[model samples]
Target: MCGRLALYSDFPSLACSLKLPLIKGELTPRYNVAPGTWISAVRRHDGSGQLSLDTLWWSYRPPWADDKAPQPINATVEKVATSPYFRGAFAHHRCLVPADGWYEWLAVGGRKQPHYLTRRDGEPLWFAGIWTERPDGKPGCAILTEPARGVAKAIHPRMPLILDQQSLEPWLDPELTDRETIRHLVHHLPHHELTHWPVSTRVNKPEEDDPALIEPLEPSAP
Candidate 1:
């Protein structure tokens, strides 16, 4: 469900990779980003029609929901267009969540083995997301997820809806509100597009943020 992510790419490199304008500020590298933390997102300005990079809280809370209401971290792709909690944002507030990679856990022989998944080509990955205004005037977003396929299926039944460069424009185009068209863009990448390997269990802790957490675990150590 994309509960954790890592973004270590520098702003300039990310800007070049995503082909979006960079905002003025220090873009800190985060190796263990968790739900509720601010995340890097790319969205089209409603008036300018230009893409801009911004930071948004990683959980989504509908406008009508109370401050105490549960904020969803992931929105199921199949229900995004029909679910009352996410439909409005799905139709009008689509965004791109840039990440170096994401973490998933697999239950293996009574133990949970954490795996780090990233693009095989080493390019930044962009996950599809929807955003909405918070009561306090800030923006919050939730990543869209679909039933897992290929290598991801070995870890869990769901994974973030990672989008390719070609799908970015249509997915974030605010004018294109047709549910079917949006749904059609929700697809899995080729099985070989992503690669995963067991990583240090240190990533299990949100506070433990460092590059070493993503390094592959020694096969004989466990």
Candidate 2:
């Protein structure tokens, strides 16, 4: 599951990559973004075919859901397209979550070890996502995850569903709603372009958001 991530590129840089209009604001470089917080995403929530970079609460619960309903941060590929809690958003509120990279943990010798995963070329990655309006009227989202591939398999059994660059527009195309049609047009970013390395456990603390947290852990460190 993808619970933590980093996005250091500013609005203009992100806009350039997405080819969308500028949002006219700057965002502080975030090296360790955690859940239950606002994060940037590109989406078209209405019939108007406009895409905007907006901050979304990194957890999801539809407006109709019960007050005590759980807020999920990641939606599994196996169920997102079919689950009652997610299918609607998956079909109509799809979005792209930009990230420089993400963090995952592995059980190593009875302890959890964090690892940083990013494109080997160092280009930013885009995570497939779904959004919905919360009961309080705030926009919320959950990242989509699929079975891990390549080196990511060694770190975890699942990873964020990173979208291929060419699939971006098709993914957000409001007119494309059929599950089979959507799946046929959109594709995951190739696993070969991604790589990972062990990092400091400091990332385990939501409060510790800094560049040093992504630094490769020293061999002797526990």
Candidate 3:
């Protein structure tokens, strides 16, 4: 599950890569974005097929749910289309969540060590997501997760459904609502496309938001 993420890329570069228009306001760098925080998402605007970037609360609350209802941060791709809490949005409100990378904790010995995972090429990562309006009429999104594969399996049993540029358009196209087709489109990034390394434990704290958190953890004193 993608509970924490980092987005430090400038708007111009991110926009260019995502095929989005240059954002008007300053895009603040987020090194330790946590669940429930507002995060950027790309989706097709209603009526028009043009893709636009918008901020969506990281946790997802279904429209029928009360304000006090528990919002989930991640939804399994396999069940998203069938789960009563997510099916409606899954068929109609797909989105792309942009991130520089995400953090996953590895259980080593008796302690958990945090690691940062990003593309080998250093390009931005886009996670598949689904959004819906809440009872208060605000938009919220949940990242889709799949069974962990390859290296990610060593850290956790699940990982975000990271998308390649080729899959973005079809995944976000509201017109293609066929459940079978959508299911087929959902896939994890190939192990070769990703790289991960242990990072400073500072990232374990949501308050520690800086580039240093992504730096490799120093060797222990001998």
* Steric collisions counted per model: 0, 0, 0
- Candidate 1, position 181, lDDT: 82
Candidate 3 or 1, higher lDDT: 1
Report the C-alpha displacement of residue 165, candidate 2, in angstroms.
0.8
Residue range 89-202, candidate 3, lDDT tens digits: 888999988899999999888888999988889888989999998776779999999988778888889889998777877888787888999767755568778888889888
How close to the true structure is residue 22 of candidate 2, measured as C-alpha lDDT? 42
Which candidate, 2 or 3, has the higher TM-score?
2
Candidate 3, superposed: residue stretches over 4 Å from native: 20-26
Query: CA shift at 62, candidate 1, in angstroms?
Result: 1.4
Q: lDDT of model 1 at residue 210? A: 94
What local lDDT score does residue 176 receive in model 2, on the 0 to 100 scale?
88
Worst 10 residues of 1 by lDDT: 18-27
Error of 2 at 100 (Å): 0.5
lDDT of 2 by residue, 1-222 (tens): 999999998776777777655454447889999999999898884866678788999999999999899999999999999999999998899999999999999899999999999999878899999999999889999999999999999999999999987899998988888899998998999999999999999888899888887788999875
Q: Candidate 3: TM-score?
A: 0.92
Judging by lDDT against the true structure, name the best candidate.
2
Best by TM-score: 2
Residue-pair clash count for candidate 1: 0
